[model samples]
Target: MSSMSARRGSRIGRGMAWAILIAAVLVTVFPFYWMVRTALTPAGDLFADSHALWPHHPTLINFKRVLGMTSAERARAAGGSGAQINFLWYTLNSIIYSAVIAIAQTFFCAMAGYAFARLRFPFRDALFGILVAALMVPPIFTLLPNFTMVKNLGLMNTFFGLVAPSVLMTPFAVFFLRQFFLSIPKEVEEAAVLDGVGRWGAFWRIIVPMSRGPLITIGLTTTVWAWKDYLWPLLVGRGEHTRVLTVALGVFLQQSPNTQPDWTGLMAGSTLSVLPVLVLLIFLGKRLVQSLNFSGIK
Candidate 1:
C-alpha cells in the first residue's frame, strides 16, 4: 500500500540521519585520538608502522621531555635549546590571558547590551548600527593599527599588550547579548523603578540576574577564543616572560635547526595545552547547554 511505502521511506530517512551524526562525531574525534596516541607512542615505534591505530609500545617519554624531565645532555643532544623550557610558565600566561579577557568582555558587553536594548537616547540606533557594521570588518585589517598603537604606548612584551585590543566587548558579543536583553520584559525594569531602585541598582539586581545565562555563554565563548588565539599574542607577547602556550609550542618547533621535527614532544605539549579547555567544557558544558536552551536561542 502507499501508506506502507511512506512509513518505510521515513524509517530510511531516520536511519540516514543517525548515520550522518555518527560519521560527523567520528570525523571530529579522530584527530584528538591520533594526537593522544602519538603522544603515548615511543619515538622509536612511531614511524616503524605508519598505519597504527594505537601504540604498540606506549611510553611517557614524550610527556617527560615536554615537562622538562629529560637530562640536560639528552635535551641538548635532541637539539633543544640549552635554556630550560618552562611549560608551566607558558600555561600560566595562557590562563591569565584567557581569564582576564573573558571577564572583561562579558561585563562590558552586558552593560552595552542592556543600554542598547533598553535605554532611549539620541542616535542610539545609529550607534548600534555602527557596531553591527564593525562585525563585517576583518580582524586582520585592524592588526596593523593595533600594533602601531601598542608600540606607541610602549605596551609590547606586557600582559597589557596581549589583552589591550580585545579586552573590551566585541561587536558580535554586543549584538548577541543585546538580542538576549531585548527578549527580557520591560515590565520587570518598570516594577524595580517603582520600588525606588535606580537604574544602576535595577541593572545589577534584576537585569544581570535574569541575563546570567547569556553572560555565562559569552564569557565561556570569549575565554575559548582568547585561549586559542595565536597571532595577536605572538606579535605582542614575544618575550619569554610574556609568551603563552601556543607561542611556546612554536618556539619548541624551531628550537633546533636541520633536524627532524620533535613529533612526540610536540604532540605531548599539544595534549597538555588542550587539557584545561577540555576540563572546562567537561565541567561547564551542561550549564552552557541549559543556559542556551533557557535563552531561547534556537
Candidate 2:
C-alpha cells in the first residue's frame, strides 16, 4: 500500500511539471501568434473579435503596404499610413550594422581574452580586474559620452558611426572569453611552440580553432544585440543612408496622421523585423547551448 502511494505521488509530480512547462510555452508563444494574427487581419475586421484566435479576413495586403507594393490610397484604405517606408533598405542597414559589430567585436575580444588568460605582463591581474569591474557600469551611463565622441568625429548617419561604439569589444565578452580560455590546457600551446610556431601562429592555428564554439556564441550574441538596439541608432543614424529596421518601425508607427495608429501595418513591420533573429536562433541555438554546457570554467 505504501509503495502504491509513493508511485502515485511521483506520477502527480511529473504531471504537474509537464503542466507548468506547457503553460510557460503558451505564455512565450502567444504574443508571436497575436502579432501574426493582427498582421493578417484586415483593418475593418480587427475590432470585430479582439479575443480571436485567428483573423476573420486574412490577407497579405498589410505586408504589401509595409513592403511598398501597395499604392498610398490602397494602404490608407487598408488602415495603414501612406508612407512608403524603405523596409528593404532598412533591413540591409540592420544587417550591415549587426554583422560589423559581431565580427569586429568577437575578434578583438578573443584577442584581448587570450592575452588576459595567457600572457604575463606587469599589472596583468589589476588590469583584468579593472576590465571585469567595468562590466558593472551600466551601458546607458556611457551613452552620452559615446554619442558626443561620435558627433565630434562627424560619423553620424554612416555605417561606421552606427557600429563604432560596439565595434571593438564589450567587457562582458572579454570576461566570458577569458574564463573559457583559462580552461584550455596550456600544454596545447606549448606543443605548438615546440613545433617552431610563434605566439601569434599558435593563437591563430591552435587557440582559435579550439575556441570556435565560444567565439560563435559571442558573435551570435553581439549580432542579436546590435540588431535590436534602438536608442543609439535612433540618435546617430536617423539619415536614410543608415537607418536600421528598429528605428524605421518606430518612424512607421508615428507616420499615421489619423488618431488611431495603423495596428496591422505596424505589426507587419514588427514581424519582418523579428524574422532574421528568429531564423538565427533556430539554426545556431543548438550550438549556443552546447557552448554554454562545455565543462570549462567550472
TM-score of each: 0.87, 0.93
lDDT of 2: 0.88
**lDDT tens per residue, model 1, 1-298:** 9999999999999999999999999999899888899888776676874569988888877777677788867755543454467777888999999999999999998899889999889999999999999999999899989999998999999988889888987998899989988988899898887799877888999999988878898898898889999998999997989999999899888874546776777888899898998899799979866765534542
Winning model by TM-score: 2
Give the Cα error of residue 235 in candidate 2, in Å. Answer: 1.1
Stretches > 4 Å off in candidate 2: 291-298
Local error of candidate 2 at 128, Å? 2.6
- Pairing residues by index, what is the TM-score of model 2? 0.93
CA error at residue 210 for candidate 1, angstroms: 0.5
Give the least accurate 10-residue stretch of model 1, judged by summed lDDT: 75-84
Evaluate all candidate structures by whole-model CA lDDT and list the values in order.
0.85, 0.88
lDDT string for model 2 (81-136, tens) is: 66677677888899989999999999999999999999888999999999999998
